[model samples]
Target chain A: MGDIDIANDTVSADVVAKFDLPAYLHSQQAIVASHLESALEPRYPERLFESMWYSLSSDGKRLRPILCLAGCSLSGGDPELAIPTACALEMLHVASLIHDDLPAMDDDDYRRGKPANHKVFGEGIALLAGDALLAYALEFILLNTRQVPAERLLRVMHTLINRVGISGLVGGQAVDIECEGREDIDLETVEFIHTRKTGSLIDAAMVTGATLAGADDDTIARLSRYARKVGVAFQIVDDVLDVIGTRQELGKTPNKDEKSRKATYPRLFGVDGSMQRARELVDSAKKEIAPFGQPAVPLLAMAEFVCTRTS
Target chain B: MGDIDIANDTVSADVVAKFDLPAYLHSQQAIVASHLESALEPRYPERLFESMWYSLSSDGKRLRPILCLAGCSLSGGDPELAIPTACALEMLHVASLIHDDLPAMDDDDYRRGKPANHKVFGEGIALLAGDALLAYALEFILLNTRQVPAERLLRVMHTLINRVGISGLVGGQAVDIECEGREDIDLETVEFIHTRKTGSLIDAAMVTGATLAGADDDTIARLSRYARKVGVAFQIVDDVLDVIGTRQELGKTPNKDEKSRKATYPRLFGVDGSMQRARELVDSAKKEIAPFGQPAVPLLAMAEFVCTRTS
Candidate 1:
């Protein structure tokens, strides 16, 4: 409470002028990347270690982790205290990616410009490594998060459970997989995937950050709306990017959703229409968090950035 | 501490005589099955619900769940209190089996006398359903388990983490998968898979039950040893049954391990020798729990059953 003051939400004029999202994201990603290295120790069964680390260590935007830290910072929580949980979120992300990219799933050959984990570690190790990461991510939070109250951790677990379990990410992924080659998929079906699959985790990231900081219910609710809207916007933009962004820009294979005949925003709405929808969502998300004023700067900028950003 | 007394450890002579393990297991399995029917209420997207429940509802000996209940009973804890965690353990086991039988993993077409989840549900749904179960199992414990303290629940999660993560079940499964099709696979490799893969869950089951019931450290350690020994013995007997029992008897494919060239105790030790080793393990495990006297009878009987029992 001492850390969070109305004054803290008001930025000095000079400080406001110097704020830069790319620079902020770069610093946040660095923090998350370094913390991630320590989060997963390479033990015996070197293959599991190597397989898990390969995708983890590979370069990515670190968006979810950054979002988590950003939310914590905005809530006036000690950002440092959120590192373990932040890393856990990233680890879970990597695990989902690893499994999603397996031969049986999306069957992608490349991720972040590297041969997919299974392409290098073999399918069995890749799949098991994903399983290990998913389970270990939860365990890491249980074992490593400190200063946060136990109930907060339980809230975090609850957040993760809803986001990761059948009601959320898994369900979204199932629908996405099920939608493959079905051209009749409506806006509801695409929204089904966008809102649940990728959206749940992003929404959880914000709630987790706010929860860790012990923010008021009002703040948490606002952030949830902000995150939910922004998450779907992010996915909508992702679909647009796949159609227009290059492999170098996306840092992986592009147009894969189209190639798989998977239902996507671009397929349903067209690129321009999807981009328009994204901007609308981001605008809505920004309004939701506007009450925080200066403290909301990063989240607002993140929403705006999600509108047209490549990769 | 108050519940555990000298008298609590004494088994009534008639209770010992009427133990009737098969009957006992039958009754316990019935309890588990009924609880499981409600453990996961099917929800739509209907495919995900269908895929998850297909394997979960399949008939098999509810060994781990029963072990958990038994441990709670031995400690004079309300057996009902252990049900949630027991169901969680079973859910996790089913998840492992679902992932294990995938085309990318074990490639099995049948499990528990029915088509494997992957075979029936498609690889993607089976995989996601497994992932859903794994995450949901943890959430279910947190959501259910009426009287357990938070710290105790945390302990249950901690047990699951160590037992099911990379160091335990998934790690063992990875090694087992890796060891497939290799002529030079050693006894140590076989032991590695046996102890870590199947053994970890069994070991955790007992510990979870004990932990839920507030068993002392000594009892937990002894139960762990008992479970470890019995798990390997169970696998050995399973391998023996695979070689000797018909499909009608085993209720699933038999001799599949030999077909895959996977190493087993029988391949390393002759059938007679494997049988002897299982007996020795059961004997040693029984000795480890010998101090518990009457309280250990069910576990003891379980050990002997693992020694020579066929499917």
Candidate 2:
């Protein structure tokens, strides 16, 4: 309970100050990254393993996996049980990034201030790397997390696949691409694109951790609410950053959405309106965590941190 | 077991043999394709769904899923229990195909004599379609497969994901791409490439089905061997067909492997030698099933059928 108070106060303050999220996220990132490296070692053609590890180890915010760990911890499960699944989330996210950087998708040759996967590895290897990452992510979840109940594991699997699947993230991406350069795209269309493109995986990450902890249906539902709010808020922040932040800060080439003429929050809602929406969503997400008492404080603070940021 | 005999003998041989595998494959292909359609129904601009579905449902072999169902039956489980998992396998397989047809990968302009996914649906939708199929496949397995225990389900998951992951299909693909035009590449490299590229998923299909049916470890091992042999034989036949089969008969662009200067069985082993190896591997694979007695007949026959086919 005391941890909750400290996290709530300190976390929001730190975020407002733009305190180092990487530093905040570093130790766990190392842990998850190492686990991923170790998980992939038994396989062959060591170069391929190196390629995957190199792509993952590249600098970025470890938000999804960290959220997964937080979700599991909030549900009173050992973070270790969440480790593999958390890694899986990271891997899946990485896969999306790899594909997203291709010439046909974003056409950007740079990622994380360096050449994109396709640029450095060539389009063929880049494609294979993405496929490998996705396949391995599921493998990691299934093979690790040995202690989680089978039903719970199955639920995690379902959540993961559904979120990443066509109806969710993939479906969203397709529409986002199609809607590009189209002037008449509406709010509903934008919402559909963002929800599936980013929201589904983020929602999966939060709920998957709790599910692994054997959280009951009600708790699971609440956790999902928290995840949805945070997920949307995260994307809003992303859009805002594209409009306001620099490439050095954000890691990839900036203003991509605008340049691509893709629909964005700022285009749909003024910057201030989007900011307000993000804050409100974060608050709603925090409220969903109230029933968890103290254990969920991290999640709550994380939500607040999501919106109260500059970059 | 007696039912097996009845199915083989009493079932109209004409229907089974004269049955155009490619034609039959697409008829039920819609069932798996519909699964993707239903999942994405709620999206805005429903046109996105319509186009994505149009691309995926166009046509496919549906081999992996059918193999999964057949494998389950051979291991003494109801084919029905394997449906969801079969769907997953198909989704995963479809995902690979979608990506393979992309300009970044195989650079093909057509598949099944239709416009490629990227060409008709555009690159963004094509990428999304692949991702959607992959995710949907995993979800289908988790949600569907009710008869199996959780442990069995986990095993099935482990098999599927691992086979599809970097060390399996993806890894093989990377190596194959790297090996292109390397006339110096030897037989070991060729074997490594093919084994992981094709063998892993085939192994997963059979092993997962058997694991669900609670086959003993020994039986599981035998099934794996059977799958590996058939997978390699199938690949060899594919290589052979690339040289000899007609475009109309095979329903795909032929002789492209040689044109691409890709390493293949016919290139490494003379045509006659490749055919001989296919027979040997098939025979050995059938022997692995010898202990399963008559119940394993379909599996054994499938192994022979794999090598015997011209296409």
How high is the TM-score of chain A in each model? 0.94, 0.89
> Residue B117 CA error for candidate 2 (Å)?
2.3
RMSD of each: 2.4, 4.8
lDDT of 2 by residue, A26-108 (tens): 87778877776677664566666666766787876678898888888877678889999888898888888888888877777
- Top DockQ: which candidate number? 1
lDDT string for model 1 (A16-121, tens) is 3466988888889989988887887888688888899999898988888888888888887998877877888888888999989987788998898879999999
Q: Candidate 1: lDDT over CA atoms?
A: 0.85
Over the stretch B1-311, how does candidate 1's per-residue lDDT look in tens digits? 34344433544445544678888888899898889999888787899999989988888788999999998887667989899888988899999999999877888888898888988888889999999999988888888888877777788888987788898999998888887898898888888899988899999999999898888887788888989999888888888888888888887788888899888888889789999998999888877765676777888778878875878
TM-score of 1: 0.95
TM-score of each: 0.95, 0.88
lDDT of each: 0.85, 0.75
By lDDT, who's the top model here? 1
